[model samples]
Target chain A: MNASSLPRWIDIGLLPVLNLIAALTVAGVIIAIIGENPFVAMGVMIKGAFVYDGALGYTLFYTTNFIFTGLAVAVAFHAMLFNIGGEGQAMIGGLGVGLVVLFLDSVLPPLLVVILAVPAAAAFGAVWGVIPGWLQARRGSHIVITTIMFNFIASSIMVWLLAGMLMAPGQMSPETRSFADGINLPLVYEVLQMAGFSVSRSPLNLSFVIALLACFGVWYLIWRTKLGYIIRATGHSERATIYAGHDPAKIIMLVMAISGALAGMMSLNEILGVQQRVILNFTSGYGFTGIAVALMGRNHPIGIVLASLLFGALYQGGAELDFEFQTITREMVLMIQGLIILFSGALAYLFMPAVVRIYSSLRKPTGSG
Target chain B: MADLWLQFVLTIDATLRVATPLILCAMAGLFSERSGIIDISLEGKMLMSAFAAASMAALTGSPLLGLAGGILVSVALSLIHGFACVTHKGNQVISGLAINILASGLTVTLGIALFAQGGQTPFLNKSERFTDIVLPFAEQAEHVPVLGTIYKEIISGHNLLVWVALFSVIVTGYVVFRTTFGLRLRAVGEKPEAVDSAGGSVSGLRFQAVIIAGVLCGIAGTYLSTAHGAGFIREMAAGKGYIALAALIFGKWRPVPALLACLMFGFMEALAARLQGVEIPVIGNISTDLILVLPYFLTVILLAGFIGKASPPRSIGVPYIKER
Candidate 1:
């Protein structure tokens, strides 16, 4: 019945599992409160997401973006930094690719341009991210505030640039020129057909692989490398790390730059892989949704993948909710996501009693059981 | 000399109008942040208020009633933020963003359902709207030479909300630094543990701050919908609430400096709006949306550079957990 009688995995994993339950319970209640049958609505949501032919691609399309953003968020989380500017960074990165896709195509081959554009977008996004990181490192400014401000700046610049400079000529709408064909990421036309399950769509592309690679790379960078050790240590105790001969400021900047680059990659993947060009609303809220994914995944790579898939399903399913049940607004899905984050964060603590009881009953099979 | 004077005068007028909403938001932020709430949802709260104000004004044909309704709704939302962050001790950032998303969808859906105008309220004519008001002496003083010109250019005419915004700043200054409630609010923010230890309720202070923020946001929202523009458009609050938050932080969380920060931001916004329609030689033509980006861009750069080492309220964004 004491500490020595506990199962180790139960102790560590119980919190995350309980958080999932709590989130689901809350989301279910919310669905009910909104006058939808929680069971039917949820079932419909799943079917719309996975049952349809092209649905998986649609789900993966959003998941691709969420995973990259979630990774970016997770990278910063490991370093104990908050990069609220991810949205801004992603946006500017989108702009970079949009520009290259639209303007530089005349000079470069499409495949080459696509290859180069992703990195270019990441670079621009990283630059956007680094300013706040630099401020936080050098001047002791709060990244939360500075990055938050930077998001506004980045979005504003996007609006201005898209509405003014990059706007397609002779178009009355306030949008940029249609991306030239060369820079677009390719569909899984061959791969999907061979798999016997792939249905081609407008936004289907190869960025899903790139996103998985990014997740793997982030995991390796944070867990495998010497730099990762220093970053993690500094995040835990900057003063102690400084005492042990590390520059805390340098670590913060590096963490932020890497995070920004990852966020930039998310934007690039979405624009290149899915949208095929940047639009004003190109992201479909992937940047913000990543925050939820990161938290729900507990900032782990595998966890991020799982959480991103769930979020991607919700996003894809939300559209179908409109077609099936006109009353179930897209807002309902967002509400569920928010509830999931809220309850999940708190559920870790809530599950401790049940976990302790289970641990005790297993070790001592007599009265305690 | 005359041309320069003209430019300066024009700039000042633009500064005042743009700054008016910002000042209210900054003051609103001042109360909440001063009491330890990192309010990221100011944008959403203001958005809701603006939506409410515009729609109400259109339906009622009464600006005064619209203003009241706006304040009431925003304050309620602010209370929701307070309850979640301060009482339930939930993650403030998440809760704030939740409120934003909630507001965004709610407003858009309601806009479509009620008005049938695709997230915009029907435009109200001058009689039905909150029109600009010219000060009495200022109007008469137009007969005087340079003084009349200066007064006319600088401060003669503006929406009545502009005056209310300026007055609200003074009120906030007096209430924040000079009053018992204000002291409690600051104490809660800077050192919640201390306040809680000293028999002061941290929750109470937080609730007060949120309500104050909500009221200010409500007024600011009304200004956006009724006073400044003829109708309410979706997401019209745009990024101004965040801009005001930046101004508050840049001003080092002090009332006076916060007002100054708001003014500077307002000037940038106004200038951008003016320049949006203005022709440029080198670029030939520039869209107003690009110009709209100027204030936000400037805020980011300035926050990073000039706002040297600004520290937030010590207990900000962290829910207060009583020591076990």
Candidate 2:
């Protein structure tokens, strides 16, 4: 069965849903192996992610980071680049944010400092990404290997800076001192309280708003811009892109820069919105998680947002599962995440032939063909 | 001078110990990548095997059983990679990445559930682990001069797996360059369509390559848990799989060169361990963290053609779909 002949809804919607189910089923089997009721765990996870007080905020807070990183991966995907350095880019972005806030908080207005810090993150991330991009473009280095190498290098750099120069004086932990009062992004509950409404506090902050805006911006840039067309063209066929008299190498670097910038913006949600300081390993594995989100979302902005929410819910609920069950730990979430990537990204088309056959049969009754 | 020689010999010994896993993994990667399959999941397979090996050794009190378990688990993973890439024509990198992530998470999750030791297996006793094998006459040779010192310090005292690692390299070199199967493997990787035209099964050869990779990685993982260390710790493979991949690229995907690359990296790590908190005369204190980054940095530089070109197989990363 030809995959292209499928309806758009089935292509985008049904396929992903089926893939997700397949992943969950595998995860369910693992849970059962560990002597837990999969259905009970699922119920617990849903309630913990959505039904509990303040859970929604925490889920959204996680979602904000995913959105930025997902968009980062999505942008690179359009250019046929697998930018796995989002983890490193985001870490460097946090460093950029940290430097700006640290230096300017005492001199500049808080708002100005915050505004400047935003671009600082993007610039740092772009620089981290561009080196690999440039290497791949000019030197014929494979971007995948270079990006993976950069992640390790980024990790080393972060450890060096945080433990040495960036470490807060008089403290043992490898983290920068907190930013000055009012320098941090406004938390969602705090904003709501200022507007005369009482709400439970969570880490969800204005970065969530920024993340939504980034989604819109990505949608506009990819669908409504010439650069998007060029990126997609390069991804579809670099030869065709060359035949069109445009430089695919330049497009690759530019797309990587954009991807890096999007990845960098994740620091806004993590550092500025939550931690208010640069910390060791602040990016966690969110950057890698973005790959799963992008693949599952099919590189679409709306799909990314939805995928990000699902992951966010999983993360928040996984934490709850860790707390509620004796055998279950947070690592189960990581396992589930791996299964999702396996199903949605690697074995993505495993069920496609079967789906195509079923759909064709339903559409054309009594047709042997 | 004698003291300095001793230090150097010890460092070389450490290099051998450290390079064992890297050499094994690089050889593993060589088999897979030379067959036009990009295997980034070497780390995951190694980690899972390490866990399996440690658990088996801990349970059965036999290193051989542990090695068997490790190989079994790794071969299973390799088959999955084959199923995805060969059967489903999925993205090879994604499959590798998923396996890696899954192994990482599953190891810890199972560790916690099974042992309740916070994702660590109980340390194996010497009886249950691969203890160092002192070479014959090493005690008598210890008192002799330079050659005897070299024999005792540099050549002796490594576990059986170190020898296995060295032997595996020789085997890999011969099999990859000297055999008909190797010729077919290289042909399939370079041009699967041509192989298909010649009535050879591209998928079958690729599957064989990955399975060979799995066996090598399994031995590497077993060496890690049972020989290099006493038992499995969470993320015990760490980034050795990646470092091995880098070494494979650095060596231009050849067995002997990849072994040399692994040794170089292992030497760097040994030197880093020695250099921790030690200030140099002119360069001042070199951070151990920075030293850890050197292998990756060098690989990137090498890949960028600062040193030499490292070309991969032409049909690498592209699944072979037979024309209807």
TM-score of each: 0.86, 0.98
Q: Each model's DockQ?
A: 0.29, 0.86
Q: Can you give the lDDT of residue A207 in candidate 2?
A: 91
lDDT tens per residue, model 2, A140-170: 9999999999999999999999999989999
Q: Cα lDDT of model 1 overall?
A: 0.78
Interface root mean square deviation of every model, in Å? Answer: 3.6, 0.7
Write one digit per residue (lDDT tens) for candidate 1, span B50-139.
889888889999988889888988998898787668776766776677677667766765666577676788997786667877777886
Q: lDDT tens string, model 1, A77-152?
A: 8888877777888998888788777877878788888888888888877888787888889866778877877776
Error of 1 at A360 (Å): 9.3
Q: Lowest summed-lDDT stretch of 10 residues in model 2 chain A?
A: A360-369
Q: For model 2, how does the per-residue alpha-carbon lDDT over B240-304 read when each residue is reduced to its tens digit?
A: 99999999999998999999999999999998988899888999999999989999999999999
In angstroms, give how far residue A189 of model 1 lies from its true place: 3.7
Q: Report how far off residue A79 is in candidate 1 (Å).
A: 1.3
Candidate 2 residues lying further than 4 Å off, grouped into runs, are A366-369
Model 1 misplacement above 4 A: A1-44, A98-110, A160-182, A194-202, A324-369, B1-11, B55-65, B113-116, B121-141, B149-160, B280-294, B297-302, B305-309
